[model samples]
Target: MTSSELWSRATAERYDAEESENSSAAAVEPALAFLAELAGDGRALEFAIGTGRVGVPLRARGVPVVGIELSEHMAAVLRRKADEETLPVVLGDMATTVVPGTFTLVYLVYNTIANLLTQDEQVQCFRNAARHLAPGGRFVVELGVPPLRVLPPGQVAVPFYVSDHHLGFDTFDLVEQTLVSHHFTRDGEDGRYRRGSCRQRYAWPAELDLMARIAGLELEERVADWHRSPFTGESTQHVSVWRGPSPARP
Candidate 1:
């Protein structure tokens, strides 16, 4: 199956339930904190705002959030969790969607950049983001470092964790950069388990910065985490902030 179809099915079935609790709290809280500080009484835009994991909580903090999401299923999920339709979400790909109005903050989270498989598509995403930002407005992205080079050839199983009753296995196809995970719960009744997978391309931080430059945005900051720690070599995730070029400069 195609990558997009695979992701649509996987997210619709098991991803929400698996990530809704502790994982969401750990990941989204820091992101929200950073967003809150950056926005500071201004409007914000969220690209690929899947399932409202971050958008819902951020909205509660009194920020007017507009979202661009590609999957209808994921958008529906976000709509259900929102209070009084607080967030206005447009159903379209982030790479080309034209969201109305300019914003002080435009953000994307959770390695969503990889959703654009080709370099041209990724560049388009940056341009689209720039189009929606007011001068000096910031565009923030949270993505992880690519781990493909470290893996051995023909190695499908990379164990995330293993306990007496459960085994979390992450399997990947190197050429396509697709990941399939199977969790086996042993203590439960026979065959009581969940299987899900997603396909995403990986891009380096430097590459993303160049794309931002091509879109007339300049890198303003790179932080290790949402708390604004300095980014270092050991950092696994990146929080890169970019600013739109001033109108008079160009």
Candidate 2:
């Protein structure tokens, strides 16, 4: 399916409540704190800010947060959490969306960059971020390393989780890096289920650095986690910092 169709279906489905709770904004407090420090009293933009998972809490900390999301359904979920006037969310694709005003920081986290499969689209995303950034602004990206090369054939990895009535299902995909998870609950007489799925491409840290260079940005820092730990070969995830060219210098 096309990316648009995939996203539409994924967002329309009712995601497992337990999964959402477990992966709540509070869970990524460390990352949020790093972002807050990076912004340093400047406005921030979150790409693909689904359900306001990061934006909501970032705003609560008195940081002006704006979001660009492609899925209207997910955006609706975010809106329900906060007043429209308080958090401004633009419904559009992160790869090509154009929003008014410049921001000191722009971030796309949790492997969201891999959602754009092609190299062209990924480079476009960086350019888009550069376009909206103020002088010397930063674009932060967080993603996991690809495990395809190491995983044994026919072996699947944990992709998603859902729980209902203390019973849950975690879907795994061996052939494709995708997942379709369902969680059902029985309430005495009747039972209901919530289902959702997501498919993403994995990326390497080095490749992303080249993409950033092509977008007229420079990699300033690479850390293994939110605490700024030095990145190592064993690290499975990364938080990369890219700096846009200053308007005065360029």
Candidate 3:
């Protein structure tokens, strides 16, 4: 039901290995700490919880965590690491799926929102996050800033990583506000490179703030990273938190 691209079984099977860097303790700890602090004494929900990368650990850290994932293939990989009761995940669209309880923290990390590919869908995602939040709860999103500055007057592509075995770049379409990331990884023994590409819609921080406002949430904090570094023009990525309105009391 989601307009986002579905990750295939092949992609899901290789996800954990290919994304080892993100799964490293260095990357997960700080983010887990940040989330755990927000989820204090309350439940946490993750959008697109691929292979339980963060959810399983967050749950282990004494937080109740649940997930909504679009791909059964990806969810299947996660199921292997944790049982259903430990980290329950519903298979559905993050923008429209309704999981049964409220959450103090609802988070979407690693530029996953860009997968929605349309402004309306992205906006709906914010609304969905709001819908799942308890009063005064927070919705967090981790996203990369559009790298348009790196694009020259005529150039439309930017290389993010280049290595002897792996090469990665992103090509942009300014008119559509979209980008497609291309990756090529070489098989050590075979000497053949495998290629993959994913298309996503990129959004600016101001635009995301507006979407949060439209969803009846207020911007609470925005930082350069999970470490709480200050966000500036030079920052390439951001972690933003929006707070839902508190209940009215007489």
Q: Which candidate is the best by lDDT?
A: 3
Residue-wise C-alpha lDDT for candidate 3, range 142-236, written one tens digit per residue: 99999999787999999989998889999999999999999999866888999999999999999999999999999999999999999999999
Largest TM-score belongs to which candidate?
3
Question: In model 1, which residue pairs have backbone atoms overlapping below 3 Å?
Answer: none
**TM-score to true structure, per model:** 0.83, 0.80, 0.98
Write one digit per residue (lDDT tens) for candidate 2, span 1-250: 2253235545444442534753565667888899998888899999988777788888888889999888888888778888777889998888898888999999998778877756677888999999888889999999876645565666555433334453444344544544333444444546654343445555578888998998889999999988899888888789999998877843
The segments of candidate 1 whose C-alpha lies over 4 angstroms from its true place after superposition are: 1-10, 22-26, 83-85, 152-191, 247-250
Where in model 3 is the C-alpha error above 4 Å? none
The pairs that clash in candidate 3 are: none
Question: Arrange candidates by lDDT, highest first: which order?
Answer: 3, 1, 2
lDDT of 1 by residue, 52-160 (tens): 8888889988888999888878887778788436899998888888877899999999888777766778888899999999878999999877655556877666776
Each model's total of backbone clashes:
0, 0, 0
